[model samples]
Target: MAPHERACFYVQAQAPQEKLAFYFAVQSGGNFDIDYEVTNPAGGVVLDGQKERQGDFVFAARSAGEHAFCFSNTMSSFAEKMLDFDVTAEHETQADHPSRQNPLPNAAKQREQAAQSLSTIDEMASRIATGLTNFHRSLRHYHTRLHRNMDTVRSTESRVFWFAVMEVAFITGVVGAQIMAIQTLFNTSGKARV
Candidate 1:
């Protein structure tokens, strides 16, 4: 991203009441922060943030249409940013379940019970899946942070080591020059006295 530049992406919701999940992280670059905004189908701001390194958001769609997710690097003057993001729309419609499509007249009661049980199980599974995804993303984010910190530490150590070496060399040169100057002065003074 360039200075004062904004990037926008669109995700379509197939139906009203659909669930939309947005996740983004700044992987590298200046300050590891960026501004983000999410707008609904009617162009109303649903969520907005500034100078955020990572965010995970889930919201229900108010209408069936395209939603906009925009990211801004306007705070960065000369550095470009690297980001990882995901947008997902989850819909729970009757059409998605095969058992709901057709029912037998004879076993209507039993089928209904089974369908309800399946729906419960399906909902639980979805929740678990979402949890795992978030955990994995968090692990990745931490790993990146640790790696960057280690690099900075190593760079500082190298600089300190070199500076110490240079200081020792400078001190040694000054001491040698002082000793030579003292010897020359003593010899000249002794010759004048003799």
Candidate 2:
């Protein structure tokens, strides 16, 4: 992004009352700070921050439509920003659990209870899977950053080492040239005019 430029994105929620979560960070840029805001479909600002490096927010969607998320570099005079962000929407299911059964026969009640138990187990497993996915993503992101940093450090070290070697060689050459010139002058002066 350029100075005073704005970058915006929109995410659409299919249903009302859906859970929308946003996480973002200024990973690298001229400055690690940016201005950001998230607005609902009604154009009302739901979340905002100024000069912030990172943010995490979870809010319920009031309506089914597009939500706008924006980042601005207006605060920076000539600095661009690199941002990493994620927006996740989870829709709550309206399925009725079998446990909410009315009065029934013994066998019927037992079957209903078993179905409810299975539903509960399935929900738990789904949650665990989602958690694991997020964890793995975070780990991969951090690992990439670590490797990039190490590469930069290694490249800088190599450049510095080569620069020092070149400097020493140049200095030695200059000293040798000066010594030779001095010796030549002395020998010429010591010889008698012939």
Candidate 3:
């Protein structure tokens, strides 16, 4: 992101009351902070913040349409920032409904009961998949941070090593010059006495 620049993204909700999960983290640059805003389809602000490092939020849609999520780097004059973010729009499934817990007794439709059980199993599988995806993202983010820190440490170590070498060379040169000057004075004094 550039100074005074804003980036906006849109997420669509197909039905009313859908859940929207928003998450973002500043990976690097400019103090690892940014300004963020989330607006609903009606242009109403759902959430907003300034100079934030990261955020995790979940909200239900008031009406079906597109929602906007924005990030701003206006606070920084020369530093650019990088961000990792995700927006998930999830619809409520029938299998997840509370009323589905107790269905009316009907012996005529044994196949329907079996189908409902399958759907329940499918929902569980989907939930597991989502969890795995989130876990993978976290792992990647941490790996990036670790790699950056390692590079910084290596650079610092190299600079320190070179500085120590230069200091040793400088000291050696100064000592050699002093010894030559003292030797010249002693030779001159001895010659004059002879």
Candidate 4:
């Protein structure tokens, strides 16, 4: 984004009290920081910050509607910013317990409990898998940036070294020429006096 500009992206939450999770970062920017704000559909601020490089947040939805996540590069006058973000909405997925005329048998209750436990475990596993994938992706991006920076450093070093070598060679040639000129002048003067 250009300097002093703000961009907003929104995700809709259909059900009230759903979970909203966001991961945001200024992947490349003037100073690796930018202004950000998260607002609910009613224009209530959920989160706000300035000069932040990254943030991971989870907020419970109070109202069901579009939630806006905004990023601003307003502090910088001449620099552009690049942002990366992911927003996820998780709704209640578990079924409510059914009303029954009689108490469930012990075995059935145990089986139901087991199923719930398994569901919870599955949800946790899925979250873990997603986290790991995002982590690896971030790692790869950093690795590529590191390699590019190293290449730039190497190029600069090589240029500086060659420039220094050329400067020394030029100075040596000039000094030699001066010495030769002085010797020739002295010889001519001595011969003329003789």
User: All candidates' lDDT scores?
Assistant: 0.87, 0.82, 0.84, 0.81
Q: Provide the clash count, candidate 4.
A: 0
Q: TM-score winner among the candidates?
A: 1
**How should the candidates be ordered by lDDT, best one leading?**
1, 3, 2, 4
Q: What would the TM-scores of all predictions be?
A: 0.70, 0.65, 0.68, 0.61
Could you give candidate 2's per-residue lDDT for residues 137-187 as a string of tens digits?
687568546654665677789999999999999999999999999887778
Cα displacement (Å) at residue 59, model 2 = 2.6
lDDT of 3 at 2: 80
**Model 3 Cα lDDT, one tens digit per residue, 37-74:** 99989999999999997777889999999999999998
Off by over 4 Å in 3: 94-109, 140-144, 147-194
Residue lDDT tens for model 4, 1-194: 89989999999998889999887766564666889999999999999999987777888899999999998888999988777678889876665434222446766776677667877877898899889967966775675466546656777899999999999999999999999998987778656866
For candidate 4, what's the RMSD? 5.4
lDDT of 2 at 59: 91
Q: lDDT (0-100) at residue 92 of candidate 4?
A: 61
> Residue 169, candidate 2: how far off, in angstroms?
7.7
